[model samples]
Structure formats: structure tokens, C-alpha cells
Target chain A: MAYVSEKKEKGIAVLSTATSIIVPAILGVSLIFTMGYSSGLIYIIGAPYQLMSLFEGIIAGTLVFSFAGYIIGSGKTYRLFAGLAFGVAMFFTVYYIIHSVDYVVPNGLLTVCSFIITGAFLPVSQLATVIYHGRFLRGLAVPAGISVISIIVIAELAILYEDSGQSNLAQIVTLMNSVTLVALILMLFVLISRKSSGTGRIQN
Target chain B: MGSGSLLKISVIIVVLMFIIIAFIPVASTSGVKTQGVQTVELESDSGTRTPIKHVINIYLENHSFDNLFGIYPFDSYTSNASLSANLSVPLNLLSNRTARDMLTEIPSGTFSTKDPNEGYVSYHLDFNHGKLNGFLNGSGPQGLTYYSAAQEAPQWDIAEQYGLADNFYAPCLSESAPHHLYYVAGYSPIINDYGPPPYIPYSQSIFGELSKYNISYGVYLNNTAYRCASWDFLYGHTDYSSHLQSWNSFLNETSDGTLPSVSYFFSQGTGKSMGPPNIILNGEMLLLYVIDAIEKSPIWNSTAIFITFDGFGGYYDQVVPPVMDGVQLGLRIPLMVISPYAKEDYISNTQMLVTSILGFIDYNWEMPALNKMVDDSYLPLDFFNFSDCRTPIEFSPSAGFPVPSNIHFSLVTNTSADNYSSLFPMEPQIPLDKLGYNRTGSSSVNLSSMGVGILNKDEHGYTPFFESVGFYSMLVVLEIAIAAAIITRYRRK
Candidate 1:
């Protein structure tokens, strides 16, 4: 019985190792493609030059979070690094995008505040990981995977709108914005509740 | 494995992934592997006999020769074969001792200044009466920055595979409008960026010349065909108007293998113009589309694609414009010749003008020179090795390799939005004071002297409201709504 249990644990470990590497790799490629298309960098289908550096930042942040998370394992240290990475990514992405289009240069305080709001999700996500254990990452990966698919669908629809000569770009953008907002909020609420309700022995 | 081993493994895997992403060969969209320039040595006798039947002139927007091809023989980008082969060196900025102080290589993909005062007066100031050192004072450091193969891989790729003319010069030392005039008629009345038509007479253009000989020709405007007023600077030419067609018509003609013998594909407006804020990627994509279309056509073998710019819009060039009839030529602009008969791995040092296209056209059709100015111009025929016809080279973008489906084969149809405004602003408020013109702020140029009543007023106002609002509103609104939703959802939970 002891030997059998040991074998099962080894299998789980191998599966977990594969999962960590493959998931982020897949997510990284999809994230780049979707974000690139949305930003008009990938598809030259009449979309103008967008904030290329900003999109690059987002992709970098995602990779850093996933890879850093895997290396540090589930702990306060991983959460801290993840949050810091997210904060930096958020700040730069906002700064570059705003800069590219000649908006009022964001003040330091505004940039800090913006990143703080966005970076708050990192800690909340870690809380969910503690509560749901190993399965939590799989659950977290679901939203990103879905988002990648959703963006591609939206892009296809945008092309249809382009072909029809009626630019519903405004509407499509609004729809995407609404969906992202709702999804983020719902995930936060679920994670926060799972933590507050004391469902599992939350590790550090 | 232990947690420590797992951590090591994760780190290794993540680093590997990033390395792969970093080294992802740009211009892989065409799916063809990057090959070195095919060193097909041109025989001395090969240059005399020519077989080029169809001439497709793609007149693009501003870029100096040095700005685009300053660092030729790009050892890093091309293959060992190209590096090992005896490549002829053209008179580039790197080779010139006079331009040594001005040889500041900007990083690849960096855009020059937006709206660099590139009118006649400013360009002359930059020219500094042929001294060529006043670029810093005239157009700022932006005029000093030049690109290598890194920023313009597709261009360099085509140049490497076929022919690049390092000494090609624009006809006029001004902005788009004047150079465009000089391109068609080999002369322009105005020297500034804009002037209302006391225009060149209609019967004087190469179009008129072609029509007179019953030779097929076309002026295909890609972006601004229908929306733009038909203010053909040609005053009273009836048949000249018939040849001016839309982008779709050009594509259809190419598709049917019925493209005109002398076809001029004009890419203008916003991103399409291959100008500032460095959107050369868009230009490259468009070039690929056009080249691919031609390759697919039945007339591919006979067609010679002369890809040249109108003027180097305030960009840095070491070469001084040569004086002809008291009008100095504009800065040296890039000219890449791509055809089956174009000499492989060749760089022509022959001094040529934008009017040289007219010269080539006239020469090819066995017609008279458009004028004395054209007659004196050196033909760009030295770039071609007509004795040996090779296969068309496939090209891909340097960065942002577009998805195959995303490559729209057709140009703009009926879209009201001018996506190419960045390439050329639709409504330029001409700096009348700088140019010494009396016309203030977007006034119509009257061409009554040439019999055309008035130049068309730009209906589309210059408001880049689409970019800022279209991009940020989506991001900001989403963030705000998410914050609100999180508050509401968290309180309920």
C-alpha cells in the first residue's frame, strides 16, 4: 500500500511538472497572437499601427507571472514577485499606450494607482491557489484559455463587419471591454469568497 | 523529483520558451526559408539586349537612399553566400568621406520626425547650397537618422535578390505634391508641398504621351481614388482622364493579365505611404500583396517593378542633389528593381531621376523623350540583366509576420475611413509663411491659368480622434467597470 501510494504521488508530480510548463507556453503563444491581432500588429487587414510596446509588455507580464510562479512554488515569496511583476507590467503598459497616442502624460501617482488596482488581482489569485490547492491553477488557466478563444472570435466578427462596410469596431470594442470587466470581477468575487469562507487550510 | 529539482526544471523550461520567442525569425509569414542573394554574374554583353515588356512603377512616399539603404552588404541579415560573393559596393553614406560626420545610424524601426518641415525652403536649408551638413539645423536630428537592413528587411531582401540603385535621386527638392507632379510630367510649376494648379497642362504628362502612341497605361490610386476630387493637374486633356483608375480596377486588370503596359501603382495616405512614426511594416505588407498579385498574373515574366520613392521627405542623405536647368534634384531616394530580368545581387551607381521612369518608359516603347530634362536623365536600365530571366523572389515582412488570412489581397474598396492618414495627412495646413505663399490655412489653389478652375478642397478634416478614443476608451472603460463590478460582487459574496 505504501509503495502504491508513492507511485501515485510520482505520477502526480510528473503530470504537474508537464502541466506547469505546457500551460504557460500555450497561453503565451495564444496571448501574443490574440493581443497582436486586436492591437492591429499581426493582421494588416487595414488596422493601423497600434501601441506595439504596450502589447509586448502584457505578453511579458503574463510569462513572468506564470514562469515565476512555477519556479517560486506556492508561497508568500511567489505572490510577492508575481504582484511586483504585475505592477511593473501594468504601469509600463499604461504609460506606453498613453504615450503612443499623445495623451496627457500620466503622472507618477496616477500610474502607481492604476497598477495598484490591476496588481491587486495577483494576490487574490494566490489566495485562490491556496484554497483550491493544485487544482486551482487549472481553474485559473480556464479563463485565459477562454479569453484567447473569445478574442479570436471577436477578430473574425470584426473582419465580417469590415467586409460589410459598416465598422462596428466601436460596438465590438465595447463588448470586449464589458466582457473583460465582468470576467475579472466575477473571478475576484469567487476567489475572495473562497478565502473568506475558510473552506480549506490556506497555506502561506 | 524534489521541489528543488522541480523549480530548476521550471526555470529551464521557461527560459527556453523565451529564447524561442526571441529568436523567432521575422519575415517567416511567406513560409519560405531565407536564402542568400543568388550570385548570377551579369555578362558584359547582357546589359545591351533588353526583354522587359511591362513596366510597373510603384511610386511610394518619402525616404532617402541613405535613410533606407545606408548600410548595404548587411552581413548579419544575408547569408554566407552573399558575404563570400564579390558584391559591387555602391556610393553609400558608409563609403562616403563627406558624410562621415552625418553617419548616425538610428535603431531599426525608429520613425523619423512626424511632419518634418519638408517643403522647398526647408529642403534647401537642409541641402545648405550642396554642403549637406545643415540637416541638423534644417530638419533636426531626425533628418540625420538612417535605417539599415534590420528595419527594412523585405526591401533589402528584394534589393539583395534583384537590384538596388543607390544613386537614384528625386526630380524635385520639395514635398509630395511637387515630386508627384515631376514624376508624371517630368516638371512642376510649384516648388512647395502644395500650390493650386497653375498646373502642368494635361497633354504634357507621360499618360498623354502613352495615349498618343496607343500604348496602354494607367495611374492606379490605391487609397484615395473615389473620395479625392478628380483634380488632374492636367488642365484640358480628355483621354488622359480615362487612364486614371481605382485600386480595384488595377487589381482586376492584373488578375485578368490585362494590366497596362505602363502601370503606375500609387500608395498614399496614412500608414500606406511608408512614412513617419515608422510604419514601414504596413508598407512592406502592401508591397508583398502587390508583388504577390503580379506574380500570380500571366504578365509576371515581362513585368519590371520599379519600386521608388517620390522624395526623401526631410530624411538624411549624404548625396547632394545635382543641378539641372537651375533646379537642383531632390535627395537620393531608394530604388529597388524587381523582375525576372533584373540583375541578381546588383547595386547600380548610375545617377537617375524620378523622371528616369518616364525615360525608361519612352525608351521601352521607342517613343520620344517627354522633354529635354528627361532626355538628359540617365536610364535605370543598367540595373537589368535582360539576357537571363530568373524566377520571382518571395518576400516577407521583417517583423509582425501577418497571418495568411489577415493578408487582404484586395486594397480598400468603399471604406470612408482613410486608414493611411499617418502616411500622408489628408488635409495639410500648408505653412504658408515658411513657403512664402499668400494662401493661408487649407485654402483652395486656383488653377485657372492651366484651365482647371480650382484644386479640390480636402473634405476629410485632420482629426486623429479614431486612434486615441478607439484604443484607450476600451481599456479605461473596461478597467473602471471591472473595479465597480468587483466592488458589487465582493459585497454580495
Candidate 2:
């Protein structure tokens, strides 16, 4: 009975690491394909071309999140934060590079920055919750679910606002990003304090 | 619930999300029909509708509006007055410097040995946020060469006889490849200077939309592969392969009265024509041949031929292109619409892009726009006047003029030639197999002749067959990875 329980624990650890890395990577790639297909379809259905940047922001966001998740899932806290920082920096770097040379979508800078901030923070917070709550897949799954729901809500709101000519999409996306960043900062503060106070530890 | 059950549920949820995200786009676009006002209509012998039966797009190589059409006598003050005599109206508006004024500022010649800087970066510097003052200063002295009206007489004669669009801009501020993609796809997903990917799936192309509606189309090229057809959607798809044909086949079909509803003709680069460092006169001759072939064909009465250049080949143009999103619209290129329904001696000022051609086709067929950019709001269809279809306009082929006989020889001898040298190094070695129709797939119907065969390698080193294989290999890897993950989880059960 003791041997069986020990093997089960090891299996859970392996599964947890694998799910944490693979799930986010899959989500990132899947979101890119989805955005590409939907943008193409929107063109076919005669939607405005300006709206494509919104989907482009989603793709960039998910890609950054996946990169951060890969590092964090390896069970290295410092490395995970470093990766997130590097990803955000690189996002801005690439945007400026493309801007200097080729044409970037108008008002794309703020939208991409917002997406990176949201994507980086949300996933890290979910990982923090997992460490504290002692739940393996639930941590990742719940956050991903919330993200999916939030994206739909944001998209719908943008469309409504655009259709009604009440506000530009870039303004809406910037506002959302601002809110997400605030929430992310608060979550990070709580997680860091808990670790410093010896109240919680990430399971390996 | 056990951890295994929880894992299974998570996987199921991810899969469900993927399916839902994927299905939404397909569901939304599946049954939607084109809506809005129809732009062009006429009472024809067959019925009361658009009299246009055939649309042919003939793509020529680089030459800007000011470079070619600046001295074409479109102004009433000029000797060749075709439009209204209004001295107050500016013949060609320039925000900072005019093309005519720039003519004296830089090298004035028929042929340029040094190519001007027309890359994406150069375009940005030259545009300068619509200040438009950087033509002579941005790219040095090479930016000021404008072809004389005498040099471009053949094209001017055609424009004067048919219709001229003085304000059409190249869709994107890039090289030939992206603009060619925009010519067919309406929107180019590729932002950089890269050539067409080896294979694009059917879902990503306007040809896919045409195939769905069973609308017959063909792409005819001299000897080179049509850049637009290089996408997997047209080449890899066995059903659409036969639609690719040679220029000769196009002529034969036109004479045989078997031309497709829509057709595209691409020039046989420098050897025959396609300008810049090569002889400009040779390109004019090729244009004359194309116009003559259509004029003598049985389908001439029902056909509308659109002739335009892909982009300004490092030449000076007076107009500053409008900015949208982050992309600055490319400089103005000459556009001529020649059809029986085309208004005589008319000059249209409708602001248009290359995608306007695609828009025109979609409007006539009642097909949905390829993308939002290809919709009526972005592209102007007012170039054609179909009010009087009873009297069909006729055109006589311009008389042949003296062309430098040894232009090809001179280019071949000059081993140290620039980028334009490779465009027409020698006469294209046309493969025999590419001359006629080679049908594939389960369908017995021979749609058209397939003329896509191996040609001289491009500068990009795109091995056609190898690239397609690489794309497929990546997809296979993705599938295997997914399968492995699932099987590993199932074994733990």
C-alpha cells in the first residue's frame, strides 16, 4: 500500500509538469490558428480591416503567455519572472523594429502591450494559486477558463462599441489592459508576501 | 473525482474550446450572401444586367503614373487635350513637388543605369508622413527620371482611346510579390518582402471562393509561374491546377471563343518587355501585342481588359499615397480600362488600389468580397460607364515603331547588370509540358490548360516541390505530437 501511494505521487508530479507546459503551448498555437481563420472569415464576410489588429493582439498575447508558462512550469520562480520580463521586452522590441521598417497596424503598439501584460500576469497568478491550493490541473484549467470567458466578453463589447460608433477598439482594449494590470499587480504582491513570510511553497 | 478523471475532463474541455473557436468562423461565413448596392449595370441583348461577360487583368511590370503618364497630354493646356478645358484644375496635384518639376531636378533619360531606391524603408523616408518632400533628397539623383511621352506613346495611345485612371495607387508599399498577392487576394497577410509561400490551402484564397461557386477562371503567363497561383490554394489543389495556362493558350482560347469568365495575363519579364533597366520600348511592344490579340478575338465585344503595373519601379511620382492602419499606400501606377463598355476619352479620378480589380469582379458576379478591403467601400467601380451598351467602342492597334533590336543582346553582354538584369537575363526556355492542359484530380472535366512547370530558380531559392513537402512535414509533426500525448494518458489508465 505504501509503494502504490508513492508511485501515484510521482505520477501526479510528472503529469502536472507535462500538463502545465503542453496545455499552454497548445492553447497558444490554437489561438493563433483560430485568430487567423476568424480574421480571414471576417474579410470574407465584409468586416472592417481595422478590426484585424484586435485578433492580432490576441495572438501575440497568447504566444507570450505560452513562453512564460513553459519557463514557470519547470518549477523555477526566478526564471519564470525573468522569462516574462524578457517576453514583454521582446514584444515591444519586435513592434518597434517592424514599425521602423514595414507597416504595422495603426494603434497596434498599445494593444499589444496590454495583451502582453494581461497574458503574462494572468497565467502567473494561476500558477501561484496552484502552489498555494495544492491542486494540480485545476489551477491552470480555472484560469484558462476565465481567460476564455473574458476574451469573449471583451470581443463582444468591442464589437458593440464599434457598431454603435461609441468608441474606438484601441481605447477599449487599452482600458481592459489597464484593469488586468492592476489586478495582476495586486495578485503578485500577495504571492510574493506569502513566500517571504514562509506561509506557502510551490510543490515540486 | 480521481486525478485521472480530472485530467480527462480538462483535456475534454480544451478540445471542446478548440472546436468551438474553429467552428465559429466557418459557421459565420458559410451561408452569408453579398449585400449592398450594385455599382455597375446595363441592358444587354441577353438581359438587363451588367453587360460585362469576360474580365481580363493584364499585369505589367514597374512604371509609376508620373514616370509614364506625366507628359501624356491629359491637361487641356497641353497639346493633346482629352478632358475638360479648365485651367483652374490642376492636371496632377502635388503636395510638395510636382513630377514635371522633379523631371529637371534629377537625371532625365529614357533608360537608367543606376536603379533608384524603391524598397520599403525608402518608401517610408520618401513619404515622410505625407510631407512628400523627399523624392530627390530621399534616394539621391536616381529618383528624378521620368519617361518622355514619346517613349510611352503606345500606352498613351491606348489610354487616350479607352479610359485612364490617373489616381490608382499600388495597394501596398512593397515590391512585386506582396502587391501581386494583393492583386489577387485583396489583403496580403505577408508583411515583408518575401515571395509567395510554396503552398497555401484553399481556405486562404479568393480562388477558393470562385471554386465554391463553380465560376470558371484561368491564369495565363508567358513562361514564368504566375506569382498569385504559386499559393498552395491554386497549385497544390488538384481541382484547380488545370486553370494555370501559358500566354499562348490564352490567345488560342480567346480566338476559339473558349476563354474563361475571368483571366489574368502576366508579362514575360525583360526579354519581351517589363521595364526599368531593360528597354522600355520592348514592354510597350508586348502591351500592343496583348491589346491586338484581344481586339482580333471573337470575345472582344464582351471582354473588359484591365492593364496596370504592379508598382513604381524606383521611379518618381508626384502624388503622396494615403495612409491606412500602419501601411502607407504605394505610389500611383498607370491604370487603363479598355472594354466595349468603357467610355470614350474618359479620365476617371476615382481613388483606387489594385484590389479594386478584384472588387469589380465580385460586384459583377454578386460574390462576397474576398475580405473587407475588397468590398465596395474600399474599391471604386465607377470607372466603367455602361449607360450606352448599344454602341460598342472599337480600337485600332497602334502602329509599330522602331525598337532597339539588340536590347536583349546588350543586356546579355553586360554581366555586371543590376537587379533588372536577372528579371530578363535571356529568353525564357519554355518547357513543352507547360504549353497545354494537363488535368488532374477525380473530376473528368478539363477546366483549362495547366502551364506551371519548372523554370529558372528565383533569387529566394524557393524549390517549389521541396517547400510543399516541408509544409506537409510540419503538419505531420503536429499531428504525431498530439497523438503521442493522448496515447500516453490512455496508457496510464
Candidate 3:
């Protein structure tokens, strides 16, 4: 019976995430594909990089969903953490795959940089979008927002200096992970403090 | 507006700042070219130009050059980046930006533009042999492995029965998939959908044609071994047979042929196929079994077996795998073509592998070796110096005494993970538990402390494999620790 319920929960989460990413992905791809028809108009309207941003949005949205599913998934101790780790790792793996392709056109170096940016964009967007959904994760929101902003700052600087090296992107992601960990810790500390500080209400 | 939110934002900012700080060094190397990609075409000896009738390919894992971290005895562990630097070999190996227009034909006797500084540093044979021998005696250094010669580890005749392709290498000396692809396709691409539902054909595979012709191929697997399994498309469909066998039994059974014309065999988990082999000598033993077959089979006459690896598994090596066709070959994985016709004391300075396998078939059968093979040739048979005229010849098997130790190579280790005390004494190195791993019908146990691997061999050497936890645990442990510490600290106020 528990197994059945667990399966159901997983199914629903999958359905929801798919529904979310698929709709936007389709719309984004369509928007992207249509712009090719009017290259001049698309370029004028900033559609060239919009496609990149939309992808970032989708990744962010997906990561938020994964986070929610984990916190809500119940069962076991750290399903959410597992999911987050997996989702991010998978996200980066995809980026590595893009960077690895040999036959990429335009310029291999540029392609690699684009992939790194695209990868960074996803995590940033996820935190930005998910922070609000955490339902006043209260003080947690501040740390989360700063984390994203910091990443963008780093990214901008990296691009300014040059974003072609593998380590630049790697360092950025590694910092993001570390900060995220720190923020989560801080939020947990705040939550426990609140619970014990004479307020007899559980925030969840 | 809240201080909490401000704090959170500040932390994020700090993290990003650190990333930028870390990236300063990387950005400093701007405009540094990453070398160039190559497409090699080796020439075959003309006099004994018999078409390829039989080809056997073997893929061993993680055991680059030598088992340990040295190329000679008593050498220390090294940090060669050939096996697994995570950097895509194509980008890291070839300078596409600078050498985009330059078309330099690959010279013969060299595999890729091999940088002698990119792979895992391997200890010499003396180190490997001495270690294994000592470990088996239970009197060795007890370093990493205890797979001494006396451990009854499966042994086979290499270097002697086959003309050793000394300069042969793994496509990339690393992970399973890319190397496997190179084992069959010659080139390893960075694919998006690399895992699951093996038959999902996002790209071209040579096995497609082999399957189309009913040439006969099979994957002897355990676990969910069929990821990105398009190799089945080459044969109408693929079969997962030989699912369960004792390591000893499988070795004994498989060396004599109970199979098809083109068979793809891999052991599960720790039993050789999916391990770094510093722990279990599964990969080496498995190769030995294949060697045993070629050394004592009727098919040995007309048969040739090529052994190579796929990608460098983010380790290290000195010989950077070459770029064949377009993809980075990864690193100098060990490659050997076993046959009577192969060079006796041969050191083939050639970049040949899966594509070469396809090249062999394509040249002999008049088929187009897809992907890289289309551009490359079956690693030219020059590794086999055919000074005299010869037609396609076939050899008979099981003719000799077939001693297992004719060319003995045993595994040993002094710093077994069971006790890396000499290395990291401050770290509590309890034999960590390898949880949830087992073979078919075997009870699960903690593999870490058990002095065994993912598949612990029993007295008779029958072992089952289990699903790897992957990196799922590290995150969990960290999460729990931080959660606990944070909760305690906040409550203290």
C-alpha cells in the first residue's frame, strides 16, 4: 500500500514537472523556431538571446519543482536533497555533453561558453523562481536571492574577463553549491530556533 | 527588506564572488589553444592482403597502462589526466580555434597527437606482478588489493600468444560508454540522452549494419547494462544472455566459445567490467579470459581480437588519447590485437580501435565503416608485419597445453583500501560499507569492509552484482550533518 502511494506520488511529481517544462519548452522552441523565419525582426527584438534565457527559465522552473517535490515527497530522510543533487548534477552533465561535442559550428570556444552560460542560467532561474514558492521560507529567501545574484555577478565578470576556460564555469557552479548548502543550513537553524522560541506553531 | 532575506542574498552573492575569484586563473589562460583534432589513416601491409574474416574486440576498464600509479616498480601514485579529466577531450586535446584551417595529415606510427602527459601514471609490470603475488600470499603490503597470484584470480596467456600491439590504446582510457562506443563505433560523441532504453538511436552506430546482416552479436550483461543500447539495432535486436555465472565458471566457460560471431561481454559492478580495478582485478581477469580463448581456440587461425577502452574516466595518464577523425581518443588505454599474424615483438605506434574494428570489417566485407571509420581505415594491419604472401588464414584452437600461467600477470596491492593507513592515517579509514550490492541469488552485504567488491566472490568464485548507490550518499550525509548542526546552533540561542 505504501509502495503504491509512493509510486503515485512519484508519478504525479513526474507529471507535474513534465507538464511544466514541456509546455514552456514547446512554447520556447516554437518561439525560437519562428524567429528563424524573421531573423531581422528576431534580432531587433532580442530574440537571439531570448531563446537562451527561456532555456534558463525552464531549467529554473524544473529545479524548483524538484525541490518542492522533495520537501513534499515525504518518506526517507533526504529525498529532496537527493533529488536536488541529482537534478543539478544532471544539469551540469548535460552542459558537459554540450561542451564536449567536436562538430559544433560557429566556434567551439564560443559554443562551450554558451553552454556554460546556459547551464548557469538554469540554476539561477530555478532559485529565483523557487524562492517565492517556498512560502516565506522567511529568512531563507534572502540567502537564496543573494546566491543567485552573486552567481550572476560572477558570471558577468567571467564573461567580461573571458568565459572560455573550463575552470571558470566549474568554479562558479562549485560556489553555487557551497552557498546553497550554507543557506540551507542557515534556514534550518532559523526554523529550529523559531519552533523552540515559545511560538507553538510549526511553519510548514 | 527583511534582514533574513538580506542575509540570504548576501550568502548567494558571496558564493558567486568566490566562483569568480576561482575563475581568475582560468580566465588568465585566454586565447590558449587546445591543440588540434586528427583523422588518422594507417596503411596495411600489401603483400599478405587477405580480407578480414573474423574480428574480436575487448574492452577493459579503469586499469590504464598499469594497475598502480607508476610506470615502474616502487613508483608513487600520479595525477595524470588521461583517464578522467572531465574536460571533453575534443576541446582540451584539439585547438579548434587556432588550427581550424590547418589540415595536417596524421603521421603513421603515432596514435592521435598523443601528448605524453595526459593519462594516469601506471606502475611497471614488476610492480603490478610483485604486488599481486604478495597480496595473494596474505603477506604482501596489503595496500590496495589482495589479488595476489595465489588468490586464484583467473590468469591467461597475453603478450605471448598474440602479437602485442604495444602502442595500441583505449579510445579514451576512461568510462564504460564512450569506450564501448569506440569499441564498436570508433568515435565517442557527447550525447544528451546517453542513459537508458539502449535502442534509442539518436546517432549512427556501425553495429546497426552488423545487426542488419544478421552477423550475430550479443551483450552478455548483468544489471541494467543496456544504456544507450543502440548496439542492438545493428542486429535487428540485441539479446542479454549469460546473465548469471560464477566468475570462475564464466571464465572457464566463456574461454571456449558458447556464443555468436560478434559477442560483447562485460562483467557487472565490481567483477571487472565497471571498476577502477585498484580494488578488484575484475577487468584484467576478464581480459585474461578473452586471451585464454584466442590462445586456445580453433578460431585462432583466422581470428583477430582487438582490445581497447572507451573514454578516460576522469583520472590521469601521460599519453593523451589522440583525436581520431574528430572526437578526442581520450588517452593511451592499453590495446592489443591478438593473433599469430600480429607482431611478435611489435610496438605498434598506431591510433586504432573500435573505428579500426569497423575499418577491418568495412575493408574486408566492402561495407562503409560509419562515423570515424568512414574517414579512418581498420587500424592498418601493419601491426602484423606480413613480410610474406598469405591468403586469409584460419587457425585451429585447443591444440596446445594451454597453460594459464604461460605469460603470468597477477594482481597485488600493498595499500588496500581496507587499510590506506599509510596514506591518510588521520582519516578514520574503517572499511566503509558497500551497501545494497549482490549478485543473483546472493545475500547483500557491506562490500567495503568485507574485503570484496561490488560482487563478492564466494569460495567457488560465484558472485552477483548489485546496483551502485552512485554519488547519492555523499549528498545525504552532508545534508543530515548540516541540518543537525544548524538546528542545534539556532536552538542554542
What does candidate 2's lDDT look like per residue over B431-454, in tens digits? 213322211111111101111121
Interface RMSD of each: 13.6, 16.2, 17.3
Candidate whose TM-score is highest: 2
Ranking by DockQ: 1, 3, 2
Model 1 residue runs over 4 Å out of place are A1-204, B1-50, B75-86, B97-101, B108-113, B224-231, B237-239, B396-493
- B367 Cα displacement, candidate 3 (Å): 1.8
Ranking by lDDT: 1, 2, 3
Task: Rate residue B237 of model 2 by lDDT.
Answer: 45
TM-score of 3: 0.40
What lDDT would each prediction earn against the true structure?
Answer: 0.53, 0.50, 0.35
Which candidate number would show the highest lDDT if scored against the true structure? 1
TM-score (C-alpha) between model 1 and the true structure: 0.50
Native-referenced Cα lDDT, model 3: 0.35
- Residue pair clashes in candidate 1: B196-B445, B197-B447, B269-B420, B270-B420, B270-B421, B270-B422, B270-B423, B271-B420
In order, what DockQ does each candidate have? 0.08, 0.03, 0.04
Better of 1 and 2 by lDDT: 1
Tens-digit lDDT track of model 1 for B117-160 = 45554566687778877766555576777665555655665676
What lDDT tens digits, residue by residue, belong to model 1 across residues A121-203? 34323322322334546555533432343334534654664453322343444454445444444544554676588643222
